[model samples]
Target: MNELGLNFLDLGDSDKLPIILIHGMALDQTMWTPQIPVLKEHYRVLTYDIRGHGLSEVGDAQYTYKMFADDLKSLMDYLEMDQAVLCGLSMGRAIVLRAYDMYPHRIKAMILSDARSEADSNETKYWRENSIESIKKDGLENFADELVGNIFCQFQFQEASGSGGVNSKHRLIIFIRGISQPLSSSQMMHDKIVNSEFKIIPKAGHMSNLENLEEFNHNLLEFLGKIEF
Candidate 1:
């Protein structure tokens, strides 16, 4: 839709509620496929490939989160969607969080999964850049191996066989350090938004939604049910 040429999937009737699902880094709109069936039953669900992530065009200019947010607005305008429930995982959540600043009224609610809502620290930023270089120097498979290992072994939310639980910031660091960071490091966003929910899918990592789709969908349906009440 629009000149941006974002590849998107729209499901359900126009008369139903609207829900937009935004995916994280290294992921495409298909990441939300498991949730679409349940969501489309009651709402018109919109799933799009963000620029440079999937099939979307990658332009020369370096972009900011706000630019991504603007692209969302452009798409919304094209679709004549006034407001919708926004659900994002990791970096996807950050983009929508920025969108709230420019168009607060456009969001009906937010679902922030496996992401913080604060600005990135210099150390975290540096570490990610370093990790990217490592990925390039080493190999994509190795990088994936390390990432998945970290998630399964060192990054479990609840206490598990070999993993540790993160009740405080110290243990949480392992989970937070990644390719797709959150919006900020403080609860300021939760306070600012007023109508938001944080869902922690246990036994899962940064890719929590994908790792545990059953529980994820259960929680999601419950959340949406509440919104209707």
Candidate 2:
């Protein structure tokens, strides 16, 4: 673990460009198992658990986007990396965005899976509050079942604004079922960012990487090939 109490695996050659993979909420770095072996061959791969998850220490401070972004920056500084490619999933996507906002120059590029870039609406906030209440009222098992039920349902398509901005021109947006976020967000991001590519892994849900590892990795590698540093 680094100075920030982040449990991480630094793989691949030290001289190579870095790729940081951030997992979704409630998930640890192991979620990126499928991509590591392949990615490590070409780039320096860094996979770590966010604070309060996996082996990482849970500090007393309330967890927020800024806190997570700061931790990411600290890790990069500790690794002596001036910049790196940030790839994230689900809540991890939000962290990647926040990190870029905080330290744009440190981000060489981004690969976002199941991406979303908008403030939570009242309905979304209520759903999250209810989820917390459900975990407290019911149990982790029940909550897991309910969450699975929600994730595996038919994909619901929604529209979102492309108002979010990023400093980097190179980005790869990947998604499965357009649930939990609007499909237009990807389109807007692709439209806004130069050298950006948008891709979809068919016959998959939110966990598209796990559901269709081949296609996901293909899109990821193809995107990486286009990047210069």
Clashing pairs in 2: none
Clashes of each: 5, 0
Per-candidate TM equals 0.75, 0.85
lDDT of 2 by residue, 1-229 (tens): 5567999999999999899999987678998999998999999999999998889998999889899999999999998999998998878888888887788778888878887656767997798778768878997688887776566425322210222666444444433333333577667666676656678776556777766678788888888887786
Q: On residues 1-229, what C-alpha lDDT tens digit does candidate 1 reach at each position? A: 4486788888898877688889986568998989998889988999999886678877776767888899899888888899877787777877766776678677776566666755667986796687668877996678767766654423443444001111222111112122233324423444443344444455555676666677788877777665541
Runs in model 1 lying further than 4 Å from the true structure: 128-198
| Candidate 2 residue-wise lDDT at 165 | 63
Itemize residue pairs with steric clashes in candidate 1.
Answer: 117-184, 118-183, 118-184, 118-185, 119-184
Give me the overall lDDT of model 1: 0.67
Give the true-structure RMSD of model 2.
4.4
